[model samples]
Target: MTSTPAFPPLKTYLTIIACALLLGGCSSGDEPASEPPRVALVEPLQPAEPQPEALRLSGVVQSVTTTQLSFEVAGRIERILIDEGTRIRRGQPLAELDRVDYQLQLSEAEARLRQLQADLARKRTLLAEGILAPAAIEALEANTVAARVARDSARRDLERSTLSAPFDGVVARRLVEPNMVVAVGTPVFEMQDNRHIEVSVDLPEIAALSIPLGPELKAEGQLVIADVSLPLRYKEHSTQPREGARTYRLVLQGEPPEDYNLLPGMAMRVSVQRPPRPQASQDQFRLPLSALQADSDGGHYIWQAADGRARRLAVELQEVEGDQALIRGDGLQAQLPIIVAGGSKLHEEQPIKVQERN
Candidate 1:
């Protein structure tokens, strides 16, 4: 009975412990909770400087002199002396036609001319002796002249059977094989003068108008081939736009390096430095497109970090080039820090922790 009197009831002990826990919770709730400040990545605005705009375009390397070679006379191709990519000299024999028929024609023509000449000589002697009529002698003279003309034509045809290179060039294509029949004026080979090369670029109408037009225009661009840059000189430009398009053809000539083989139809790049635009304004800032935000009225704006708070700056988008937009706005300067990231969640006069972009 003495040991039982020293312990308290189980229900009473439970109620006392619950009341002490409630008092501890009420005391801890008196202090307010604190949150970390929101981070904002910022970068300085870049002022757009008035500089020469570089227009990069795709171009193709071509020979300045490209010609399609054909035979002057029709016959079977007896021999093709050059293959594709064979270098040739001026007047070098390139191909030959079957010569057997042409040779026979020349021989027949020569025999006829000889016979007429002998007959004419005999007739002249008879006329001097008064044994032949004057009319007959005249007729014989006419026949002799006709025979001479025939002989010359036959000889010219025989020479034409052999095709020769018109200039120093490399054979680019061979359209005929040996013993293949070809018609007169049929293209037998394609040749190009590789010593002089030109680059062809198709530029839009706006870009074409910017190029200076004069004989003294020099070194306006560079032709890049396999990472090698070569100086380019403006040769010519087409007045009419390219067929079925609004682009004009621009031809630029360049001397290839001694160790480089610049061939026709080779793909390359052309970088043209356009002259600085006259009266172009430079009071704009070039900013990343992502830094721009839209207002409730559909106007564009940007966030500027001022005094550890977000400030709204209204901007007018002047131009968008690639991923960057050129904007002009009030209070937009190169020295101003612009919030590029975490700006969508910012409000007016909101505190921000700035993190400078490296």
Candidate 2:
């Protein structure tokens, strides 16, 4: 029958409608809410004032005078009075070769010289008595001169059989042992003058060129073994670039501390102060390293907050010192807000809420 549809009570109908309305409201609320702008820590750009650029480099301690000692005469080593690392004075005897052969040669030369001298004297007497011709006396005199030269050479050989120090130095190495026969001019010892210590460092060609001429370049050194820093004088530098490198060798000399023995092969740190470049002083800005970012092509960039948004700016990285970076860009200005901490996730023109870094 078309009897009136069975209707729920009015209260029940109201409750069902209320439930539907609540479910609809929940569904509407399911849509995502827009996120607030990302917060970023920022600091004002600082202009890099014109200051001396300090270049620090590792250096090696070297002896100013290093020489290889050799015997002038070949002989068997008979006695080695000093070992490696022995400190010696100039002209101090260091080693001796077997002098027996040298002595015998000297004796033979002396005997021959004596015999020639006697013959020359007898011939001169004969000439005086008119028994020898002038030419014969002249020939005898020439032979006596030759014998004298031979004797002097033999004496020189005997003296050279003993090796003596050429200068005050320390023996760096001893190459021969007792009873070992060595040839003439064979290296027997390596000596170094440790009293005059030199430090050598490699400098880039660019840096070497930037140094001012006529003694304006200043340098100092700190020994790795000691805490003292000493003023260094410019000793010399290589005129050409080092082999296979675009660097020049810079040598500096300094007096060592009395308490410390600054020996060869020791390490040192050298600091060279270069004058500022006029062209770069105005455009350069110093920022924290965190403010820098790299693109896919390895180009560097930084973010600047303007009008409450992050703006990507291209920059050229000049140098880095500790946690700070020196950079240059066309439009960069001092006192501009730069996003330092939260720049990694920022896109170009992204809205940013910046917190000033004190």
Query: Largest lDDT belongs to which candidate?
Result: 2
| lDDT scores of the candidates, listed in order | 0.84, 0.88
RMSD to native, candidate 1: 12.9
The parts of candidate 2 lying over 4 Å away from their true place are 1-53, 213-216, 243-245, 276-358
Alpha-carbon deviation at 331 in model 2, angstroms: 34
TM-scores for every predicted model: 0.59, 0.61
lDDT of 1 by residue, 67-107 (tens): 99999999999998988989899999999999999899999
Model 2 poorest ten-residue lDDT run: 209-218
Candidate number of the best TM-score: 2
Off-target runs (Cα >4 Å) in candidate 1 are 1-55, 220-225, 242-246, 273-358
Alpha-carbon RMSD, each predicted model: 12.9, 13.9
